[model samples]
Target: MIHSVLEFLTDELNTFIKLKVGDPTTTRIYLSGVTNEAGIAIPDQSLGISLINIEEERVNKDQQNRFVNAVGKVEKRNPEIRLNLYVLITANFQNKNPNNSSDDYVEGLKQLSYAISFFQSKNVFTPENSPGLGSFDPNLQKIVVELYSYSFEQLYNFWSVVGAKYLPSVLYKIKTISIQENAVLEQGEPIEQIFTQSQHKS
Candidate 1:
């Protein structure tokens, strides 16, 4: 499910970038903070998306449904593991410009602005908006992407925790993804309602 979600985002964002850059092959997206098993850097230099955090969603617990079979056999399943995902999208363009003016920082800011607008304009991804998403993971009903803001102190700490120097990046939260195990914890007969006819008083 995680892979599918990321794949969907990667395709959506990169497709936009491809149109903007007028190339589909070169301008691509990569999963950020990734390295080969041999400790070698992977090929990148496009928009990079990296998962930063995941939190369980407690609100969906009430949505789970108890099952009663045809024979009035009752069964109960645990609530789904609802979760929210936080990922960082960083412009992976080269830091150096052709003019040799060291405008990489400026380029990053510009790209970040563009990315923010793209999300703002269309923040919802679902079967209706993006059919490919459901193909990637059928269980994915919808994905709501929202920008997350951080204070200066928090940003500094976040970068420190990432163990990398800060780059031009944006934080987005993908929310309400859930997973339910099919195991039935309990099974029993459904309660029967009995109606007794009152005898006429004589």
Candidate 2:
């Protein structure tokens, strides 16, 4: 499910960027880590979408463990675990020329800005509104994207932890990814009535 969401988002962003640049074959955005399995940095002239962190959402958690199934029987299962993912979108565009380094740096920032703009305009996505979203995950109902701001100190610490030089990037908090197991603990008919007896004390 996690992969499905990220893939859909990456594809959407790629399409958006290609249209913005007026090139149908442009593939500027991709789903990848800041570094590869060999710890090599991302390629140049690309935007990488990486999952940096996952935090459980504690508020308004579902407590119901029983629901009516299609067969009209009540089934019990564990509640879904809601999560908020911290997704980092980084731009790694640099001109190889030493004298043109500043210009290339600005280009990276510009690409990053396009990403920010894309999310700013459309922060919420649902299968109904977004075409082909259900193809990725039929169970995925909706996804909300919010810009996550961090202090300079926090940013520095993050880069240090990642063990990579800082690049033009933006962080977004993805809200409410529900993960639940399909194994039912129990099944039974719904209670049709409640029986109680009250007797006067002797």
Candidate 3:
């Protein structure tokens, strides 16, 4: 489910960028991170969406785990876990010439700005609004994206943990992904009546 959500975002953002750049078949946005086998924090001349953190949304939890099935049998299942993913989008574009790297540097900033604009225009995604999302995961009913701000210290710590230098980037909080399993922990037949025991006075 997490993979599907990220892929959906990447595809949507990539389309928006292609339209803005007036180029078809332009693939720039991708699901990636600073830490990779190649040790490249950011790919050259592309935007990488990375999952930086995940937090469980503890508010408004459903504790009810038992329900009657269609066959009138009692069934018990664990409640789903709701999660919020902190995603970082980084743009890394560098020119071949180290001396003339300013152009690519600015280009990276422009790409990053495009990402911000795309999310600003449309932050909430539902099946009604985004039909493609249905193909990704029918269970994915809704997704909300919000700009996440960070303090200078926090930013520094993040970059340090990533083991890479900072690039033009933005952070977003992707909300409310549910995880549940179908295995029933317990099952039983529905009780139809209550039995009473009678005893003599002695």
| Pairwise lDDT winner, candidates 1 and 2 | 2
lDDT of each: 0.74, 0.87, 0.88
Off by over 4 Å in 3: 97-103, 191-202
Provide the lowest-lDDT 10-residue window in model 1.
34-43
The true-versus-predicted C-alpha distance at residue 110 of model 1, in Å, is 3.4
Kindly indicate the candidate among 1 and 3 with the higher lDDT.
Answer: 3
The total of clashing pairs for model 2 equals 0
The segments of candidate 2 whose C-alpha lies over 4 angstroms from its true place after superposition are 37-40, 97-103, 198-202
Candidate 2 per-residue lDDT, tens place, 1-202, comes to: 8999899999999988888778788688889988755653666777899999999999999898999999899999999999999999998866666566533878778778889999999999997789789999999999999999999999999888888777889999999899987789999999999999999998
For residue 48, model 1's alpha carbon misses the true position, in angstroms, by 0.9
In candidate 3, residue 85 scores what lDDT? 100
Model 2, TM vs. native = 0.90
List the RMSD of every prediction in angstroms: 4.4, 2.3, 2.4
Model 1 residue 111 lDDT score: 55
lDDT of 1 by residue, 9-29 (tens): 888887786776577687556
Model 2: how far residue 3 lies from native, Å: 0.5
TM, every model: 0.81, 0.90, 0.90
Write the number of the candidate with greater TM-score, choosing between 1 and 3.
3
Per-residue CA lDDT of model 3 for 74-118, tens digit only, reads 999998899999999998775655675533788788888999999
After superposition, the stretches of candidate 1 with alpha carbons farther than 4 Å from their true spots are 34-44, 63-65, 69-72, 94-103, 194-202
